[model samples]
Target: MQITGYKSQGVAAAVDLVNAVTTVEGDASFAALREILRVNGFFWHEFEERDAEPLRRWGRTLREFFDAAELETAVSLLNELMLELPMHPHLADHDPHGLHLHFAPPTARLPHRFRASTLMQLSELVVQHGLGRTGTCAAEGCDRVYADTSRAGRRRFCSEACANRTNVAAFRARRRTPRTPEGTG
Candidate 1:
Protein backbone atom coordinates (compact mmCIF):
# COMPACT_ATOMS: atom_id res chain seq x y z
CA MET A 1 0.00 0.00 0.00
CA GLN A 2 2.49 2.61 1.24
CA ILE A 3 5.26 3.14 -1.30
CA THR A 4 8.37 4.98 -0.08
CA GLY A 5 8.55 8.33 -1.92
CA TYR A 6 7.66 10.28 -5.04
CA LYS A 7 9.43 7.88 -7.34
CA SER A 8 7.73 4.98 -5.66
CA GLN A 9 4.43 6.81 -5.69
CA GLY A 10 4.72 7.57 -9.37
CA VAL A 11 5.57 3.98 -10.21
CA ALA A 12 2.79 2.68 -7.98
CA ALA A 13 0.29 5.04 -9.55
CA ALA A 14 1.29 3.85 -13.01
CA VAL A 15 0.92 0.22 -12.04
CA ASP A 16 -2.44 0.92 -10.39
CA LEU A 17 -3.75 2.69 -13.46
CA VAL A 18 -2.46 0.00 -15.81
CA ASN A 19 -4.02 -2.75 -13.74
CA ALA A 20 -7.29 -0.86 -13.53
CA VAL A 21 -7.52 -0.59 -17.30
CA THR A 22 -6.45 -4.14 -18.16
CA THR A 23 -9.17 -5.99 -16.25
CA VAL A 24 -12.15 -4.70 -18.26
CA GLU A 25 -13.20 -6.01 -21.67
CA GLY A 26 -11.62 -4.68 -24.91
CA ASP A 27 -8.14 -3.35 -25.47
CA ALA A 28 -9.12 -0.01 -23.92
CA SER A 29 -12.70 0.90 -23.16
CA PHE A 30 -12.62 2.10 -19.56
CA ALA A 31 -11.74 5.78 -18.96
CA ALA A 32 -12.17 6.26 -15.24
CA LEU A 33 -8.67 7.26 -14.14
CA ARG A 34 -9.87 10.47 -12.49
CA GLU A 35 -12.22 8.58 -10.20
CA ILE A 36 -9.50 6.04 -9.59
CA LEU A 37 -6.95 8.73 -8.75
CA ARG A 38 -9.42 10.65 -6.57
CA VAL A 39 -9.80 7.47 -4.56
CA ASN A 40 -6.06 6.71 -4.76
CA GLY A 41 -4.45 10.20 -4.90
CA PHE A 42 -1.62 9.75 -7.39
CA PHE A 43 -0.63 13.40 -7.61
CA TRP A 44 -1.10 16.75 -5.88
CA HIS A 45 -3.06 18.09 -8.87
CA GLU A 46 -5.98 15.85 -7.97
CA PHE A 47 -6.04 17.46 -4.51
CA GLU A 48 -6.10 20.98 -5.99
CA GLU A 49 -9.12 23.01 -4.87
CA ARG A 50 -9.19 25.44 -7.79
CA ASP A 51 -10.54 23.28 -10.63
CA ALA A 52 -10.16 19.59 -11.49
CA GLU A 53 -11.75 19.63 -14.95
CA PRO A 54 -8.37 19.79 -16.63
CA LEU A 55 -7.10 16.89 -14.57
CA ARG A 56 -10.24 14.87 -15.34
CA ARG A 57 -9.87 15.39 -19.07
CA TRP A 58 -6.21 14.58 -18.80
CA GLY A 59 -6.99 11.32 -17.04
CA ARG A 60 -9.53 10.38 -19.69
CA THR A 61 -7.06 11.06 -22.49
CA LEU A 62 -4.41 9.01 -20.74
CA ARG A 63 -6.83 6.11 -20.58
CA GLU A 64 -7.59 6.45 -24.26
CA PHE A 65 -3.89 6.28 -25.09
CA PHE A 66 -3.36 3.41 -22.65
CA ASP A 67 -6.19 1.51 -24.29
CA ALA A 68 -4.53 1.92 -27.65
CA ALA A 69 -3.28 -1.41 -29.01
CA GLU A 70 0.04 0.21 -29.78
CA LEU A 71 0.59 1.22 -26.14
CA GLU A 72 3.64 -1.02 -25.82
CA THR A 73 5.17 0.49 -28.91
CA ALA A 74 4.37 4.01 -27.77
CA VAL A 75 5.77 3.41 -24.30
CA SER A 76 8.93 1.86 -25.70
CA LEU A 77 9.45 4.83 -27.98
CA LEU A 78 8.61 7.26 -25.20
CA ASN A 79 11.00 5.57 -22.83
CA GLU A 80 13.73 6.01 -25.40
CA LEU A 81 12.73 9.65 -25.81
CA MET A 82 12.63 10.30 -22.05
CA LEU A 83 15.93 8.46 -21.51
CA GLU A 84 14.78 6.68 -18.34
CA LEU A 85 17.20 4.35 -16.66
CA PRO A 86 16.43 1.42 -14.44
CA MET A 87 17.02 3.35 -11.26
CA HIS A 88 15.00 4.77 -8.41
CA PRO A 89 15.90 8.19 -7.11
CA HIS A 90 16.50 8.73 -3.42
CA LEU A 91 13.89 10.42 -1.25
CA ALA A 92 14.30 14.17 -0.87
CA ASP A 93 11.99 16.37 1.19
CA HIS A 94 9.67 18.81 -0.57
CA ASP A 95 6.81 21.25 0.07
CA PRO A 96 3.73 20.02 1.96
CA HIS A 97 5.25 16.58 2.02
CA GLY A 98 8.06 14.63 3.60
CA LEU A 99 11.21 13.23 1.94
CA HIS A 100 10.48 12.29 -1.68
CA LEU A 101 12.33 12.45 -4.94
CA HIS A 102 10.21 14.15 -7.54
CA PHE A 103 10.07 11.61 -10.32
CA ALA A 104 8.23 14.11 -12.51
CA PRO A 105 7.56 17.83 -12.65
CA PRO A 106 4.34 18.83 -10.95
CA THR A 107 3.86 21.60 -13.53
CA ALA A 108 4.57 19.43 -16.54
CA ARG A 109 1.81 18.83 -19.05
CA LEU A 110 -0.53 16.08 -17.87
CA PRO A 111 0.23 13.81 -20.84
CA HIS A 112 3.96 13.92 -20.24
CA ARG A 113 3.68 12.91 -16.63
CA PHE A 114 1.04 10.34 -17.42
CA ARG A 115 3.13 8.59 -20.07
CA ALA A 116 6.40 8.84 -18.18
CA SER A 117 4.99 7.56 -14.94
CA THR A 118 3.12 4.74 -16.64
CA LEU A 119 6.11 3.53 -18.64
CA MET A 120 8.40 3.79 -15.63
CA GLN A 121 6.04 1.81 -13.42
CA LEU A 122 5.41 -0.80 -16.08
CA SER A 123 9.12 -1.18 -16.56
CA GLU A 124 9.48 -1.55 -12.80
CA LEU A 125 6.80 -4.21 -12.74
CA VAL A 126 8.56 -6.18 -15.44
CA VAL A 127 11.87 -5.98 -13.61
CA GLN A 128 10.68 -6.40 -10.02
CA HIS A 129 7.70 -8.74 -10.32
CA GLY A 130 8.37 -10.21 -13.78
CA LEU A 131 6.09 -9.80 -16.78
CA GLY A 132 4.29 -13.00 -15.76
CA ARG A 133 2.48 -11.06 -13.06
CA THR A 134 1.03 -8.66 -15.60
CA GLY A 135 -1.84 -10.39 -17.33
CA THR A 136 -5.38 -10.19 -18.70
CA CYS A 137 -8.52 -11.15 -16.77
CA ALA A 138 -9.23 -14.88 -17.29
CA ALA A 139 -12.96 -14.43 -17.79
CA GLU A 140 -13.95 -14.65 -21.44
CA GLY A 141 -15.13 -11.35 -22.97
CA CYS A 142 -13.25 -9.43 -20.27
CA ASP A 143 -10.06 -7.83 -21.56
CA ARG A 144 -8.88 -5.98 -18.48
CA VAL A 145 -5.35 -6.39 -17.18
CA TYR A 146 -4.59 -7.91 -13.80
CA ALA A 147 -1.51 -6.99 -11.76
CA ASP A 148 -2.12 -9.93 -9.40
CA THR A 149 -1.91 -7.94 -6.17
CA SER A 150 -3.72 -10.71 -4.35
CA ARG A 151 -1.91 -12.88 -1.84
CA ALA A 152 -1.96 -15.61 -4.42
CA GLY A 153 -0.90 -14.24 -7.79
CA ARG A 154 -3.62 -16.48 -9.20
CA ARG A 155 -6.13 -13.74 -9.81
CA ARG A 156 -7.80 -14.47 -13.15
CA PHE A 157 -10.86 -12.27 -13.43
CA CYS A 158 -10.89 -8.51 -12.92
CA SER A 159 -13.60 -8.70 -10.25
CA GLU A 160 -15.65 -11.11 -8.20
CA ALA A 161 -18.59 -10.61 -10.53
CA CYS A 162 -16.59 -11.83 -13.51
CA ALA A 163 -15.19 -14.73 -11.52
CA ASN A 164 -18.67 -15.81 -10.46
CA ARG A 165 -20.00 -15.45 -13.96
CA THR A 166 -17.21 -17.54 -15.44
CA ASN A 167 -17.66 -20.23 -12.80
CA VAL A 168 -21.42 -20.38 -13.44
CA ALA A 169 -20.85 -20.57 -17.15
CA ALA A 170 -18.37 -23.41 -16.70
CA PHE A 171 -20.86 -25.29 -14.53
CA ARG A 172 -23.55 -24.87 -17.15
CA ALA A 173 -21.20 -26.09 -19.88
CA ARG A 174 -20.48 -29.19 -17.84
CA ARG A 175 -24.19 -29.83 -17.44
CA ARG A 176 -24.89 -29.36 -21.15
CA THR A 177 -22.25 -31.91 -22.14
CA PRO A 178 -23.92 -35.30 -21.94
CA ARG A 179 -22.19 -37.66 -19.51
CA THR A 180 -20.77 -40.86 -20.98
CA PRO A 181 -22.48 -43.32 -18.59
CA GLU A 182 -19.43 -43.43 -16.27
CA GLY A 183 -17.88 -46.60 -17.84
CA THR A 184 -16.43 -45.13 -21.05
CA GLY A 185 -13.95 -42.35 -21.55
Candidate 2:
Protein backbone atom coordinates (compact mmCIF):
# COMPACT_ATOMS: atom_id res chain seq x y z
CA MET A 1 0.00 0.00 0.00
CA GLN A 2 3.03 2.24 0.34
CA ILE A 3 3.87 3.50 -3.09
CA THR A 4 7.22 5.21 -3.57
CA GLY A 5 7.06 8.97 -3.79
CA TYR A 6 7.94 9.38 -7.47
CA LYS A 7 5.98 6.32 -8.49
CA SER A 8 2.93 7.57 -6.64
CA GLN A 9 3.12 10.87 -8.47
CA GLY A 10 3.55 9.05 -11.77
CA VAL A 11 0.52 6.86 -11.21
CA ALA A 12 -1.53 9.92 -10.36
CA ALA A 13 -0.40 11.63 -13.53
CA ALA A 14 -1.14 8.57 -15.62
CA VAL A 15 -4.63 8.21 -14.20
CA ASP A 16 -5.27 11.90 -14.66
CA LEU A 17 -4.18 11.76 -18.27
CA VAL A 18 -6.35 8.73 -18.97
CA ASN A 19 -9.39 10.27 -17.30
CA ALA A 20 -8.86 13.58 -19.05
CA VAL A 21 -8.80 11.90 -22.42
CA THR A 22 -11.36 9.10 -21.97
CA THR A 23 -14.08 10.92 -20.11
CA VAL A 24 -17.34 11.57 -21.99
CA GLU A 25 -16.73 15.29 -21.72
CA GLY A 26 -13.00 14.99 -22.31
CA ASP A 27 -11.20 18.22 -23.20
CA ALA A 28 -8.42 17.53 -25.64
CA SER A 29 -7.36 21.15 -25.85
CA PHE A 30 -3.72 22.22 -25.63
CA ALA A 31 -4.35 24.31 -22.53
CA ALA A 32 -5.88 21.40 -20.67
CA LEU A 33 -3.05 19.12 -21.65
CA ARG A 34 -0.49 21.66 -20.55
CA GLU A 35 -2.24 22.02 -17.23
CA ILE A 36 -2.19 18.27 -16.72
CA LEU A 37 1.54 18.14 -17.36
CA ARG A 38 2.24 21.06 -15.13
CA VAL A 39 0.17 19.68 -12.31
CA ASN A 40 1.84 16.29 -12.75
CA GLY A 41 5.29 17.90 -12.24
CA PHE A 42 6.56 17.28 -15.71
CA PHE A 43 9.90 19.12 -16.14
CA TRP A 44 9.41 20.14 -19.70
CA HIS A 45 11.12 23.12 -21.26
CA GLU A 46 8.31 23.83 -23.68
CA PHE A 47 5.01 22.53 -25.04
CA GLU A 48 4.23 22.90 -28.73
CA GLU A 49 0.87 23.07 -30.51
CA ARG A 50 1.93 20.08 -32.59
CA ASP A 51 2.38 17.91 -29.50
CA ALA A 52 -1.34 17.57 -28.79
CA GLU A 53 -2.11 14.69 -31.16
CA PRO A 54 0.74 12.52 -29.98
CA LEU A 55 -0.07 13.22 -26.34
CA ARG A 56 -3.71 12.37 -26.98
CA ARG A 57 -2.69 9.08 -28.56
CA TRP A 58 -0.47 8.35 -25.56
CA GLY A 59 -3.39 9.07 -23.25
CA ARG A 60 -5.57 6.64 -25.18
CA THR A 61 -2.92 3.96 -24.86
CA LEU A 62 -2.66 4.58 -21.13
CA ARG A 63 -6.44 4.19 -20.92
CA GLU A 64 -6.10 0.71 -22.41
CA PHE A 65 -3.95 -0.30 -19.44
CA PHE A 66 -7.02 0.03 -17.23
CA ASP A 67 -9.12 -2.03 -19.64
CA ALA A 68 -6.98 -5.06 -18.91
CA ALA A 69 -8.84 -7.74 -17.00
CA GLU A 70 -5.75 -9.24 -15.41
CA LEU A 71 -2.40 -8.14 -14.10
CA GLU A 72 -0.51 -10.20 -16.65
CA THR A 73 -2.52 -8.66 -19.46
CA ALA A 74 -1.77 -5.19 -18.17
CA VAL A 75 1.92 -5.99 -17.92
CA SER A 76 1.90 -7.24 -21.48
CA LEU A 77 0.30 -4.02 -22.68
CA LEU A 78 2.87 -1.99 -20.76
CA ASN A 79 5.67 -3.96 -22.29
CA GLU A 80 4.27 -3.42 -25.76
CA LEU A 81 3.99 0.29 -25.19
CA MET A 82 7.52 0.54 -23.82
CA LEU A 83 8.81 -1.21 -26.86
CA GLU A 84 7.00 1.12 -29.22
CA LEU A 85 8.01 4.28 -27.40
CA PRO A 86 11.41 5.90 -27.86
CA MET A 87 12.94 6.38 -24.43
CA HIS A 88 16.50 6.98 -23.32
CA PRO A 89 16.79 6.46 -19.63
CA HIS A 90 19.26 8.56 -17.68
CA LEU A 91 19.86 10.13 -14.29
CA ALA A 92 19.50 13.83 -13.67
CA ASP A 93 19.80 16.31 -10.76
CA HIS A 94 17.60 19.05 -12.04
CA ASP A 95 15.38 21.57 -10.17
CA PRO A 96 16.33 20.43 -6.64
CA HIS A 97 14.44 17.16 -7.06
CA GLY A 98 17.84 15.65 -6.17
CA LEU A 99 18.94 12.74 -8.33
CA HIS A 100 15.95 11.19 -10.03
CA LEU A 101 15.52 9.23 -13.21
CA HIS A 102 14.56 10.73 -16.53
CA PHE A 103 13.32 8.35 -19.18
CA ALA A 104 13.73 10.68 -22.13
CA PRO A 105 16.83 12.52 -23.22
CA PRO A 106 17.20 16.18 -22.33
CA THR A 107 16.80 17.18 -25.96
CA ALA A 108 13.61 15.22 -26.47
CA ARG A 109 10.36 16.97 -27.18
CA LEU A 110 7.57 17.53 -24.68
CA PRO A 111 5.32 14.66 -25.76
CA HIS A 112 8.22 12.25 -25.79
CA ARG A 113 9.34 13.27 -22.33
CA PHE A 114 5.82 13.00 -20.94
CA ARG A 115 5.24 9.64 -22.58
CA ALA A 116 8.49 8.13 -21.41
CA SER A 117 8.20 9.34 -17.82
CA THR A 118 4.54 8.42 -17.43
CA LEU A 119 4.88 4.98 -18.99
CA MET A 120 8.03 4.08 -17.07
CA GLN A 121 6.62 5.22 -13.77
CA LEU A 122 3.38 3.37 -14.34
CA SER A 123 5.30 0.25 -15.23
CA GLU A 124 7.15 0.46 -11.97
CA LEU A 125 3.87 0.79 -10.14
CA VAL A 126 2.43 -2.27 -11.83
CA VAL A 127 5.49 -4.20 -10.80
CA GLN A 128 5.35 -3.06 -7.21
CA HIS A 129 1.61 -3.32 -6.77
CA GLY A 130 -0.52 -4.95 -9.47
CA LEU A 131 -2.78 -4.15 -12.39
CA GLY A 132 -5.71 -4.45 -9.99
CA ARG A 133 -4.61 -1.18 -8.46
CA THR A 134 -5.48 0.69 -11.64
CA GLY A 135 -8.94 0.70 -13.24
CA THR A 136 -11.91 2.65 -14.49
CA CYS A 137 -14.53 3.94 -12.08
CA ALA A 138 -17.34 1.47 -11.25
CA ALA A 139 -20.02 4.16 -10.91
CA GLU A 140 -22.70 3.97 -13.57
CA GLY A 141 -22.05 6.36 -16.49
CA CYS A 142 -18.64 7.32 -15.07
CA ASP A 143 -15.67 5.97 -16.98
CA ARG A 144 -12.83 7.86 -15.34
CA VAL A 145 -9.64 5.90 -14.59
CA TYR A 146 -8.08 5.69 -11.12
CA ALA A 147 -5.05 4.40 -9.25
CA ASP A 148 -6.01 2.52 -6.08
CA THR A 149 -3.25 3.39 -3.64
CA SER A 150 -5.33 2.47 -0.64
CA ARG A 151 -4.03 0.10 2.00
CA ALA A 152 -6.76 -2.45 1.24
CA GLY A 153 -6.50 -2.04 -2.51
CA ARG A 154 -10.27 -2.04 -2.73
CA ARG A 155 -10.87 1.28 -4.43
CA ARG A 156 -13.33 1.06 -7.33
CA PHE A 157 -14.23 4.61 -8.19
CA CYS A 158 -12.36 7.62 -9.54
CA SER A 159 -13.45 10.00 -6.77
CA GLU A 160 -15.46 10.27 -3.55
CA ALA A 161 -18.39 11.65 -5.49
CA CYS A 162 -18.60 8.55 -7.68
CA ALA A 163 -18.17 6.23 -4.71
CA ASN A 164 -20.86 8.03 -2.77
CA ARG A 165 -23.20 7.94 -5.73
CA THR A 166 -22.73 4.19 -6.11
CA ASN A 167 -23.17 3.60 -2.37
CA VAL A 168 -26.39 5.63 -2.36
CA ALA A 169 -27.77 3.72 -5.30
CA ALA A 170 -27.01 0.41 -3.62
CA PHE A 171 -28.63 1.57 -0.39
CA ARG A 172 -31.74 2.62 -2.25
CA ALA A 173 -31.89 -0.67 -4.07
CA ARG A 174 -31.69 -2.70 -0.86
CA ARG A 175 -34.37 -0.57 0.71
CA ARG A 176 -36.70 -1.18 -2.26
CA THR A 177 -36.25 -4.95 -2.20
CA PRO A 178 -39.10 -6.84 -0.56
CA ARG A 179 -38.24 -8.92 2.49
CA THR A 180 -39.90 -12.13 3.59
CA PRO A 181 -41.70 -11.80 6.92
CA GLU A 182 -40.45 -14.48 9.33
CA GLY A 183 -39.76 -16.78 6.33
CA THR A 184 -43.49 -16.93 5.51
CA GLY A 185 -42.94 -15.82 1.91
Best model number under lDDT: 2
Q: Candidate 2: what lDDT?
A: 0.83
Off by over 4 Å in 1: 1-32, 44-101, 106-111
Error of 1 at 177 (Å): 1.7
Model 2, span 56-144: residue lDDT tens: 88889888898888988898999998999988989998764678888899898888888888888888778777877888889999989
Which digits, one per residue and each the tens of the lDDT, describe model 1 over residues 11-128? Answer: 4455455554443322222345554454444553444333344444433433433343454654564456457423334454666567644445666555455555655655555455
Pairs of residues at least 3 apart in sequence or in different chains that clash in candidate 2 = none
